[model samples]
Target: MTNTQHEPRLFADEAAIRRVGEGLIARTLPREDWTHEAHLAACAWIVRMRPDIAPERDLPAIIAAYNEAVGGVNDDAQGYHETITQCFIRAVRLHLARAGQADLPTLVNGLLAAPEGQRDWPLGFYSRALLFSVAARRGWVEPDLAPLPTVMEA
Candidate 1:
């Protein structure tokens, strides 16, 4: 009989989480070569991280907003695209903004410190970084934390 006990996830460690977040941010620039799977993964991660945002509840409106902003091209795009992820990220931001929860660092930290089993920590880490990137671009949040040195810089 094969014992199927799962190994405990360690990405919840602050350092590990920071590393994952930094890695995602470092690689997710210039918007080059982002695959459909990656965009879907980001959306999935975001939903998992913030179930209260309820992608089902917000995705339609988000998509509509994205389509409107981009001149309705997104509706004709095939598969999971960067626009999809961008829309979802913006939707989450809008939801939080409506609730007056604009402290992104605090939100990210709280999600990181959540019980490991309750969330996909690695994906959550990536999603938080993605969210930060979007927020920073829109001037919605400031990047005020200690910078995580990337592999290229190290």
Candidate 2:
């Protein structure tokens, strides 16, 4: 992966990372559908970033669940955000439960535990950073975490 001088720090702290995972779950639970690549990529990102949250062995089942949930749509454009978020959330929850953490549901549900309309800027920002970092690490795409477009020269 190419190093950037200004790479965004997504997992700056343990609580912050957990919050992002919870936010992902909160965004995913209500959705009825998902996408395969998006799910796989997201799960992979979470696992890569926080192996303790999700063991590598659980990836196959997580991917399978996402595939089954989507019903074989295979379209890249279908519910990108929801699917990705769900995959990360599911992976973490599955890992916690499988590892006997005893607080899986609480951690998963904590995202919505926050009051309505409360802005989770760090979670939102870091989620995107994690996605870009994972994509670049896996060579799936170029990493572009820039918040704004570059100014063009005449």
Candidate 3:
């Protein structure tokens, strides 16, 4: 749960999402720029542009590497939250599917405008205690508040 409620930094075009995604992959993005909107934008870009990389299967490691590169840690208390990442992946994938074949900027912008794109979106499904727990950070923990959409639903 690296997200905090604040004004979103909207993407102006496909290039903006690309910069976040490419910078994240290369571990070159500045720590302060990895905002909640940026996280969703990067995930959307990865899900749409990079066919070889499966976000659900690979993003955890990618994020962990990026965290370390930015002088962050992936310990139990912080960094690389599995539950939140998986939830966002599902939400982004579903949003992408529903969006059909839109431009990256449109899709990213739309996502930022949706409920799931908000910094506190996961709170709708997870209790703060469970969502921010050490177990949740290290591995996926089932949402205690509500059931998120399943793969079939997505």
Candidate 4:
């Protein structure tokens, strides 16, 4: 009925994907597939559910919460609360650490073949991002644009 944009997503316009990637660089320009809010919700659920094994199973609901939260109770973007992105990253890392894992990145790579050295976004962006998120929130992964602050003192 209505003209849809960014559809058949795998075939999404390269320009659009580039724009999304660039926008992901900074929080300034938002993408059609914003992950932050959903990431937060998922992270929060992880904190609550505290799965001892295979936490990934519960991830979808968390993403949904984030998506739902972002748009508002009714999905109005204004209804979303800006996640304290750093805190979210830190929390996930801490959770993983406390869960007795080696570290977020190593754990992630072990789980998903996500190379720690590459600058390229994952071939499976969302899956990789979700796992990497644990590292990001936990402070295992440090990026300049991140909202987190340094805690370890020299």
Best by lDDT: 3
How close is every model to the real structure, measured as TM-score?
A: 0.26, 0.28, 0.92, 0.24
Error of 2 at 118 (Å): 11
After superposition, candidate 1 runs with Cα above 4 Å error:
1-35, 74-154
Please report, as a residue range, the 10-residue window in candidate 1 with the lowest summed lDDT.
Answer: 142-151
Q: Highest TM-score among the candidates is held by which one?
A: 3
lDDT of 1 by residue, 28-140 (tens): 32233232223333334444454555554554444345434433443223322332244335433433334345244344333223332222322333454643353333323
Ordered by lDDT, highest first, the candidates read: 3, 1, 2, 4
Deviation of model 1 at 98, angstroms: 33
List, residue by residue over 2-111, the lDDT tens digit for candidate 2: 22233222233445444444434444322332322223224433653556655334443444454445453323333223323443444444443343443333332332
Evaluated against the true structure, the overall lDDT of model 2 is 0.36
Clashing pairs in 4: 38-66, 71-75, 71-76, 89-136, 89-137, 89-138, 90-137, 93-138
Better of 2 and 3 by lDDT: 3
Residue-level lDDT for 49 in candidate 4: 38
Two-way TM-score contest, 1 vs 4, winner: 1
Q: Model 4 — TM-score against the truth?
A: 0.24
The clash count of every prediction, one per candidate, is: 0, 0, 0, 8
Name the candidate, 2 or 3, with the larger TM-score value: 3
